[model samples]
Target: MSKDPDLELVKRFKEEGSLESFRALYERYKDKVFSTAFAICGNYAEAADVSQETFFLIYRKIKRFSFKSRFSTWVYRLTVNVAVEKRRSRKEFLALSEIGEEVFEHTGDTPLETLERTERDALLNRSLRHLSPKLRTVIVLRYFQGLSYEEISSILGISMGTVKSRLFRAHRELSPLLQRPPFSAPPGGQEDAWQGN
Candidate 1:
């Protein structure tokens, strides 16, 4: 496998405590971290807070990072944990309606298609809010974040079997709520992506 692109930068920051290296890593992952946090927390402000807290924790704990996993995987796992913690503190579950632009591609569809897609995406976002955090995380990690089963398993610290099972359950729960075809996976993602290994 190819080396993780961030490995050198991570090494620089971890070994030399280079502020520039840390900034580079931050710029690289900031959007992804914020997007993952928003998908989980649903509120932009809370997601921003989660993103901030995530990097803060990373800054303080970088020296302890075991290189057992890819650096990006570690960052994603940290982001998910922080987002989950933030969600636990809030009473209301918010919908990710604002993320439509990020979640769906702009394929230059007709005006009617655009409107329909927007409405459908809104429904899907609202439906997602009804799912428990555990189920939601799998959906966000797999479909929203476009992560593979193995990557998700690693990020969640769960077995691949458990990851597949949770995705199955999430699909079952979402089908009725959608009241249409199940939500599509991320662009370029296969329909069989969720199937058994």
Candidate 2:
């Protein structure tokens, strides 16, 4: 078998009725699909459901898949669509949860370091949630998933220039969010710690 035996297996599944080949392909891409889902959904349980739904769609639609793009790209597009739909449905629920009062508290480093890091991460996530879904998708795909611009454009079925423009705009939006008040000090700002000297 070649390096990506799953590709061959997918072909076989399409040509013949090979359940084993289909299962092989499913196993090969499940983790990547799940990770993509979790990155968008931010909840492990929902991600798992989305991952399963993604594969189910793949199996049903595999016959319609053209080989014009890589299999991974096709799978990623499906996963993203499912995640986006789920997010849309739960928008009201998320908004309600956001309204709950939670005081901003930071623990120092050491065992405290982890807590501080967690708080910072939560803050960043909250900021990201404010961005439009399109902008958020571009940020997640580029930064978290580490996909190339070309890959993102292909998966999104958009022009490369559009992807670049969205990324630039997303950074512009995120910069101000990162620089506001408490987070203004930047990641490791000694000056902020010793202010009012």
Candidate 3:
């Protein structure tokens, strides 16, 4: 039977210790790995670190992989694990909206829209913090990182049904926080907004 191309590359790397085989894998998946890390980290430096270490770990550990799952799935799991570990080791884990706007800026938007988007992203990031790490991971992978259910299931080492349920619960938890009207401060010298006039 013909081997999967990625598996073939892995085989060549294992048998021949070929730099080219490994490089082929790196070139194919680096962007995906980097993007996944960046979305979780919300910072370029940390993401770069995660990407570098993830690939390094893959190089060191790929031999033990049993081929039970897709190679991409294994890569995603490794990348996410390394990124979360990096964030956990820090006293201040970088939050989502803490990211620079310039890094994510897109074309064809008015200044007003940009400001609104930035604010909304900040608010979403804040709300995300209130969730448990598991739920937060699901939300980030599903919504923020745009991964599909099957992909997320593999990445998180969970069943697809579990991924869906986690996302459901996450959205439920976030709904109250996200669905509320935009916050407005009381006028100067006025009573708190919660107080009846």
Could you estimate the TM-score for every candidate?
0.81, 0.72, 0.73
Task: Please rank every candidate by TM-score, starting with the best.
Answer: 1, 3, 2
Model 3 compared with the native: what TM-score?
0.73
Deviation in angstroms for 47 in model 3? 2.2
Better of 1 and 3 by TM-score: 1
The worst-scoring run of ten residues by lDDT in candidate 3 lies at 187-196
Task: List the candidate numbers ranked by lDDT, top first.
Answer: 1, 3, 2
Task: Give lDDT for model 3.
Answer: 0.77
Task: Report the Cα lDDT for residue 186, model 3.
Answer: 29
Question: Which stretches of model 3 miss by more than 4 angstroms?
Answer: 1-5, 180-197
Instruction: Identify the leading candidate in terms of lDDT.
Output: 1
- Model 2: pairs clashing at backbone N, Cα or C within 3 Å: 109-113
Candidate 1 per-residue lDDT over residues 1-197, each given as its tens digit: 45889889989999999999999999999988988898898777888899999999999999989788888889999999888877777775566656546546668799999878877776777678767889999999999879999999999999999999999999999887788444544225655422211
Residue 144's lDDT in candidate 2: 71
| Candidate 3 per-residue C-alpha lDDT over 21-86 given as tens digits, one digit per residue, 9 for 90 to 100 | 999999998877887777677678888899999999989997788877778778889988998898
lDDT of 2 by residue, 4-48 (tens): 435677788888968998888888888778767766776667778
Give the CA lDDT, 0 to 100, for residue 19 in model 1. Answer: 98
Clash totals, every prediction: 0, 1, 0
